[model samples]
Structure formats: C-alpha cells, structure tokens
Target: MRILVTGGAGFIGGHLAERFVIDGHDVVVLDNFDPFYDTRIKAHTVERCRERAAGGDGSYRLVEGDVRDADVVAELVEEVDYVYHQAAQAGVRPSVEDPRKYDDVNVDGTLNVLDAARDTGIERVVLASSSSVYGKPRYLPYDEDHPTTPVSPYGASKLAAERYACSYSEVYDLPAVALRYFTVYGPRMRPNMAISNFVSRCLDAESPVVYGDGTQTRDFTYVEDVVEANVTLLAEDAADGEAVNVGSTDNIEIRTLAEEIRDQLAPDLTLEYEERHDADADHTHADISKANDLIGYEPTTTIREGVWKFTEWYRNDRDWYEPLVLNS
Candidate 1:
C-alpha cells in the first residue's frame, strides 16, 4: 500500500507514519513543520520516523510542505493510495488567541486535501478529528451522533473539516472516515498540552498549575491505540463516510491524573490551583461502539497505566524537550 500522511512530522502524525511504514507500506509524509510548538520537537518527531524507516524494509519519504497549498497537496495525492489527513493548527488556548490561523489551516487546509483527493482519485481519507467538537456533552459517553456545538475555534475548524470530508465523499465518491480523537497522550504529546506542561513543571519541582478545581474529567486515549485504529480502518469495509470516536470509555478526573503523574515521576511535587481557564471543557468521554463495529477499535491503555508510560517516555526522551523554553 502507498500511504500519504499530512502533518507526518507532528506528534500523532509522526507516530502514524512510522506505523504504516513498519507494516510494509510505502509511506510519504507531507508537513510544513509549522512553528506550532518548538520546531525542534517537530524535527525530533521526523527523526524518530527516519529511525524507523532506517530499521524497516519498506521505503519512506518526507516532503516539507503545508496541506493548505493546493498544488502541493494535489501533487502528493497523486502518488499515494490512502490519504491520512492529520495536519492542523492544534490546541484550544492557542486557538483562542488566534482563531483565523486555525480556520485557515484546519478548515482551508482540509478543503485543499479533499479537493486534491477528489482530483487524484484517492479512494480513502482518514481525518484526525477531535472530541472538542462535541463541546459540553449532555450525555456521559459521546457517540458519533452527538450534536456538534464546538466551544472553541479549534474545535469548530475541525468540525468544518470533518463536514468537508463527508461532503466530498458524497459528491466526489471519495470514501472518507473521520475519527474524533479524545485527549490523546503518550510519547510525543505536544508541549502545550496539560500533561506535557504539568510534566515539565514537575521535572523542575515547580508547582504545576491546575484549572477549575481539578474536578474536570477526560477520556485520555493513548497514541498507539489511535494509530492502530487508523490502520484498522484501512482494512474495514464498514467505515466509509463514517465518523468514529477513538477513545476508551473510561474517564479520569484531572486531579487524580495529576497526582498519579506526580507519584510516578516526582513524588514530592504539589499543584497550584488557578482560576478556571477560558475555552476549557469540564469533561469528555467517548462511546466507541461505532469504532468497534466498524474497525474493531478498543483502547488498550488505562489512565493510570498511560500516565506512567508517558512519564517514563518524557523523562527518557529529552531530545523532544525544548531546552531554550524550559522553565521559561
């Protein structure tokens, strides 16, 4: 199989690209290496993929480009069998500061990918959507049918991208699947994320900041499971034009998660509570029934287990840590 992964140098995208190549597929990664996080972190992600490619029998390639560039997208779409569109401007707090950049990258970039897929006759597209699209869910486990009332520009832009994928599937006969990834963590988590931020603070023995009384819950999914779900979708016939929730049904409170990290990584660390952050949701849990039915997707990591795993990786993977910004 020939696979084209947009944002292939990103946290999740890099992992996904590595998995595809390891499975004997020819892989091409397209990423602009946007300064969303430290470019060094993104560069390290690509370096990890390069290591995998060096170790594997299958061939791999990386193209430094943005998905918003229609010409670049179309050129790459012409070379691959399946298109995994994972590139987007990420993070909620950052989106609040600059919403137009989110719209341009997440919304317009998705449109570009879809149009290129249509023009090139790519059969399948797997989009990395987000649980933020569900907003404050009225129910416990958010199903694929959950109403999408996005609270942040980042979520809104992602929802728009998913809609575009579905629309293209209908109009251009391009089969597409959108997976709403919930609170994904583990190796290569973006530095701006709560887990990464908290871990960095803990490493320095600084009191980690907590928002909203730390009672908010999240359905944190591990990155390996997310990669497996994407791969499973490629072989499943039932996923066409489907939106699946890629998450464990389990939920963990923010305080419990933080304490677990502290105990595992820095036993003496304490948390500093702050006023609730804007654009932050109270809770998120996913109903994976659709994913299970379509792609046999099931999360293999619990919150406690995942936190330990991520902490271990964070401590060992100093190359991913931004030295200049440390304690800044």
Candidate 2:
C-alpha cells in the first residue's frame, strides 16, 4: 500500500506515517512545518519517521509543503493509494483570537485536499474531524446524530471541512470518512494541551492550572487508539461519507485529570483555577458504538492509564524536547 499523510510530521500524523511504514507500506508525508506549534517537535517526529524507515521493508519519504498549495497537494495525492488528511490550524483559544486564519487553513486547506483527491483514484481519504463540532451538547455521550453548532471558529472550520468531504463523497464519488475525535493526547502531543501543561507544571514544581471551576469533563482519547481507528478504516467500507466518533468511550473531570498528573511528582501540589474561555465546552463524551459497528474500533486505553503513560514519557522527553518547546 502507498499512503500519503498530510501533517505527517505532527503528533497523530507522525504516528500514522510511522505505523504504515512499520506495516510494510510505502508512505509519503507532506507537511509545511507550520509554526502553529514548535517546528522542532515536528522536526523530531520527521526524524522518528526516518529512523523507523531505516530498518523497515517499506520506505518513508517526506515533502515539506503546504496543503494550501493545490499543485503540491495534487502531486502528493497522485502518488498514494490512501490519503490521511490530518493537517489543520489547531487550538480553540487561538482560533478565538484569529478566526480567519482558521478558515483559510482548516477550511480552504481541506478543500484543496478534497478537490485534489476527487479524480485521483484514491482508495479512501480519512478526514480528521473533531468533537468540538458538537457545541454545548444537547445530551451526554454525543452520537453521530448530535447537532453541530460549533462554539468556536476552530470547531466551525472543522465542521465546514468535514461537510465538504461529505459533499465530495456524494457528488464526486469520492471515498471519504470523517472521524470526529475527542480530546486526543499522547507522546509528542502539542505542549499547550491541558495534559501537557499540567504534567509540565508539575515537573517544574508549579501548580497545575485548571480554568472554569474545574468541573468540566472531557472524553480524552489516546493517540494509539485514534491511529488504530484510522488503520482499521483502511479495509472497511461501511463508514464512507459518515462521521464517526473516535474516542475512549469514557470521560474524566478536568480537576481530577489535573490532580492525577500532579500527584505523579508533586503529591502535595495544589491545583489553580481561573475563568474558563467562552469557546470551551462544559463537557464532552462520545458514543463510539458507531465506530465499533463500522470499523471494529474499540479504545483500549483509559484516561487514568493514558495520563500515567504520558507522564512517564514526558519525564524522559522533557530533558531534550523541553528546551525546544520553550525556545520555539
């Protein structure tokens, strides 16, 4: 199999690219190395991919480019059997500050990927959607049928991008499936995420800050589970043109999660709180039954376990990666 992973040098994209190569599938990664997060983090992921390819039967190649460039996207899509569109401007708070940038990258960049895949005989294009599309949920454990009233520009852009994917699947006979992800975290995750921040602060002997009274809940999915969901979709056809939840099917309160990370190193450390951002949702839980039915997806990592695993990785990684994250 030949696979093309956009944003393949970031967290999830890097995992997918390396996994595909390890499974003996030729993989090509396309990323602009956007400074949205630290470029050094992305550089490290690219190096990981290269090292994985060094001993594997499959080959890995990276093309440094932007998805917004139609010519670049079309060229890359033409070379792959499958497409994993994972590139986008991420972050809710930042989106609040600059909505148009989100629109241009999340919306227009996605349009470029979908449009390029239209006639490329691509087997499947897996779109990385988000649970944020379901604003202030009408009910708990949001199903595929939940209303998509995004509260932030980031969510709105994801919703629009996924809608375009569905339209292309319907009108252009494109095979695309949108996976609406809950809060995803794991090794090499963005440093600004709550888990990352909490773990970092605890390591530095600082208080873990939780905004908005710390009562909110989140269905945090581990990166490995999300990678499995995408890989499973490679052989399944039942979910084409549909949005399915890729989550752990469980949730945790913000304060509880913060404490869990804090206790790993600073059992006596106290948690701090502040007013929550308006764009933040009070809670998020996913009904992953649809994903199970469509692609045999079942999350194996619990929040407690995931947090512990992340903390362990951070303890070792921060020695080298922290300086880059801080400098960047």
Best by TM-score: 2
CA lDDT for candidate 1 = 0.85
What are the Cα lDDT values of the candidates? 0.85, 0.91
Worst 10 residues of 2 by lDDT: 319-328
List ranges where model 2 is wrong by over 4 Å. 324-328
Model 2 TM-score is 0.97
Model 1, backbone clash pairs (residues 3+ apart or across chains), number: 0
Model 2 C-alpha lDDT per residue in residues 211-262, reported as the tens digit of each score:
9888899999999999999998789989999888999988999998888888
Q: Pick the candidate with the highest lDDT.
A: 2
Q: List all candidate RMSDs to the true structure.
A: 1.6, 1.2
User: Clash pairs of candidate 2?
Assistant: none
TM-score: model 1 vs. ground truth: 0.95
Could you give candidate 1's per-residue lDDT for residues 1-328 as a string of tens digits?
8999999988899899989878878899999988777778777777777788788876689999888899999999999989999999998978999999999999999999988888876768999999999987788889988899999999999999998888888888889989999999878777767787777778877767778799999999989889999998677758888778999777988887788767766788887898986799889999999888878887898877777787777778765474623633
